[model samples]
Target: MSDEKVKIDVPEVPSVLPPAEQKKWVETYKAAFEEAQNDDPGDVVKQRQSALREANRLLRVEKITSADQAKALPKWKLVQCEEKDGVLKVVTIDGKKYSFGVGRGAKQQAPAGQGGGQNGAGQQGGGASTPPPAA
Candidate 1:
């Protein structure tokens, strides 16, 4: 395999959140989402939407440029990934949406020293790699 390092263009993550407010955002989002899920008011959709909006407002997504960046984002804050026009859009708790095109000529290269080689077999006098019986 070619020993070329694949250049994966990751999304640009903005330092929007302050260190002090990290916990606050996490707690607020969890509480609001949980409330909407458990309370089950008549207008469940509306309630959930409102909660999502608040969470989104607090999330303050600044710049999401690519799918790799979107994937790199913390899973806790992500709601889902939507596809549109051959692009993958990342939706973060009803916040600003960002998308990236797939198969944009991204190269696939293996690391320099980690070639696909056979793993050590029967190192412990066994045909397959297995653990000793429980004692």
Candidate 2:
């Protein structure tokens, strides 16, 4: 087999600003570089190394190994949770509703009719169920 290495080309990120804004960016870079050079070399190197290490640590991918750990993750406030027709309906404080199917052989309980099909905003189920107010 040939030992030639495959080359991959990466496209440059496109800038949204016009050419005039690009010139202003160069000025900003020069000012920042000058300010950085004014700092002590040893201190600057230490700070840069620390920042890079922290950034790499943060960027590293993490896996959730357990259901308990996954449940402990930060999430939106649950406004309401109820079981309806073998489906678990969860509504969050932001008015988003999610439905999860109940597993086979699991206990199925009928949800109380109170607050059924209504969101935390007191509005009926989303999408065409309620008419828009008159303009």
Q: RMSD, each candidate, Å?
A: 21.2, 19.4
The sequence of per-residue lDDT tens digits that candidate 2 reaches over residues 22-43 is 4454444444434443443335
Error of 2 at 81 (Å): 0.6
- Leading candidate by TM-score: 1
Reference-based lDDT, each prediction: 0.49, 0.40
lDDT of 1 by residue, 80-118 (tens): 665544556566753554445556432211111112222
Q: Candidate 1 — which residues are off by over 4 angstroms? A: 1-58, 82-86, 105-135
Pairs clashing in candidate 2? none
